[model samples]
Target: MDIPSNHSNHDALWLPFTANRQFRSTPRMLVSAHGMYYKDDRGHDVLDGCAGLWCVNAGHTRPRIVEAVQKTVATLDFAPAFQMGHPLAFEAADRVARLAPGNLNHVFFCNSGSEAGDSALKIALAYQRLRGEGTRTRLIGRERGYHGVGFGGISVGGISGNRKLYGTMLGGVDHLPHTLDLERNAFSRGQPEHGAELADALERIVTLHDASTIAAVIVEPMAGSTGVLPAPKGYLKRLRDICTKHGILLIFDEVITGFGRLGASFAAEKYGIVPDIMTVAKGITNGTVPMGANIVSDTVFDAFMQGPPEAIDLPHGYTYTAHPIACAAAIATLDTYAEEHLFERAAALTPYFEDAAHSLRGLPNVVDIRNEGLVAGIELAPRDAKTTRAYEIFDRAFHEGVLLRYTGDIVAVSPPLIVEKAEIDRIFETIGRLIRQVA
Candidate 1:
């Protein structure tokens, strides 16, 4: 095989959330993808085990999405989303709102997960102030939470590595203790039997900061990016109750778990919980385009609606808020999901997936395994102090024809909803081999 080369120097790009030097040295490049595999620049078919960063729920290059973009580009590619409006944009939002849980009937569009997070935080702050809670400026996040890299996101986000470089982020942010207790919860299957009491940490924060000044609490119904940590049994319910009692908004950052990763349409629905707002991206367009959404309830939307029309209800949005092409892709993605019944497919396949996922329990160095719906997290012991065994397995799997995602020592596999039983077998089989070979 010939060594691949970038047309220009790769260092100038300055990648995000990446080890630029390490990645540029041993670059893994993909040229095309279809169904459950990606054709790398080396012309090797790499099986997808992470659903392309937990998006691409429909898999890659679905014909509906391809055709949607093809025809849309010719008809109308770029249109100003500011003062001007488009029918496709409204149609997509209307459909999305209907699918989202509760009276989450209002949708605000942006370009990515970070934008969605920042926008939702702003909405929470602005909503409280608009409704006479102007003093409520504090935001709450859970430790180990991953809410993208925007300024407001970094403030409420709990990842130390993602925040340490940015200096003191937006102040007045408090964190709920993350519910990943490896000692009591190790090797647990599905939701852990213990740790429901961790939700009371919210009350402790409330005692110290006072709920009157807290604007919102944002958490991933199932935390991703910082490894996969599901909310403990009954934990999410208690959080919702506390937020209700204190008049603080609850925002579910569903950027990864939304769009059927959890079997249902969103984690909010899968777990029987609803939030004041939901931030979604990734699977919304099946990773075909860059788009995200801040889903708000009718109450929140109505609060903003009361102000003067010319004054602007909520002074937030991007120039690409509702780009015509993105709207077209999203509409087609939804239609494809309906035609294929992908969500129902994922739900039905969960038992099979869970069985296959948990079968890795006794592998060497394996410490824990957790699975719910189509998502699985296989954790291994660290090789050295601050060394990530997960990354080792990830590299081996990718080099051996499977693409899996790793954060520290945890390997997260949430394949596209359209994945077949054979592909699921392949994913785990590759992972099992990689685990036994490393160290």
Candidate 2:
């Protein structure tokens, strides 16, 4: 492997989800990463607090995953996904399906969570039509839910900032009210005791839209990108019951919560609420290679299979649907998780992680703290009308030897599942100190 020389010009590349101009001015570049730490360009060892954007569950650069990618690329670099078959693709799909709950036994591979979102939506809409309910075209999502950036995802997604600039996205898309209730559930541990009735909003939406017109309701079991809002206790069960009653398919965008992030194989298993379709990525390949998948129940897959034997059941797919390298990485990643028992490790660490996170309750400008499993969110009060305090803390924390993620006024902490007790303590203590310094 050859390391490329450091390029002096940063203007050639535009970073995603970043203030590019601000980033170019004083760049914080990571040169390498391993285990729970990243080495930045300045030769500083930074603690990975957010697990590289909530991915990298088994930690970074594990030998098995790295070797798999290298060996697969050299042996079978690219395989056409449209018609050509590959043994690795089938094996990988089987592995992922076995981890999923219930009859979610079929897998559709794609390149990222964004593609998985669009793919899942298409599956729901097509499944409804195949079952002779073609009128079911409307899709539902919740406020502040982040479901990647595809047009289909954005239409169902409820973040105003992500939607406003994109113009009127897909029609017949509606959103349920968000579950974040600062006054009622602030600083609560695990799932908040209040706001369970928020799921009733789905019932209201069903009434307003007429259940016949709705195809699916997509949501994150534990909303991650919109600052880590865990589903209220009983909230998911109510949604599940309502969707089942109305004949609407339920989809869980578990890109952030899948693959042991919630101390279970997936949030569906953790909450015991199996969705009709589930989108997963990030941890699928341990963030080593880009891969996402839509795992559907047997009922949904069977509906599409009723057509002619030679016919293509679903017309949607990506060019890199089951890229050979990605399949190799995913298989190795799953192997790492099982061999190391990382999921059980994460479950054991949840209580300690939660306690460490809540220790910032008394810090200045700290408004609320919420957590579930291995993830947490520390929300800060706005300095003015703008929400830059969290970003400031994030920047300071990076310079002070910790890497964190900031969205709006909230900073998220989701370290690798392999993180130790001391590293967890260091992560929160750094944030606690930085919160005061920024204030």
Q: Largest TM-score belongs to which candidate?
A: 2
For model 2, the stretches where C-alpha displacement exceeds 4 angstroms are 1-8, 385-387
Candidate 2: count the clashes: 0
Clashes of each: 0, 0
* lDDT over C-alpha atoms for residue 217 of model 2: 96
Give residue 15's error in model 1 in angstroms: 2.6
Residue 438 local lDDT, model 2 = 80
Per-residue lDDT of candidate 1, residues 215-285 (tens digit): 99999988888778878899999999999999999999999989888888999998888999999999889
User: 222-339 in candidate 2: lDDT tens per residue?
Assistant: 9999999999999999999999999999999999999999999999999999999999999999999999999999999999998679998889898899999999999999999999
Relative to the true structure, how large is the alpha-carbon lDDT of every model? 0.90, 0.94
Top candidate on lDDT is: 2
Q: What is the lDDT of residue 190 in candidate 1?
A: 70
Question: What RMSD does each model have against the real structure?
Answer: 2.8, 2.7
TM-score of model 1 vs. true structure: 0.96
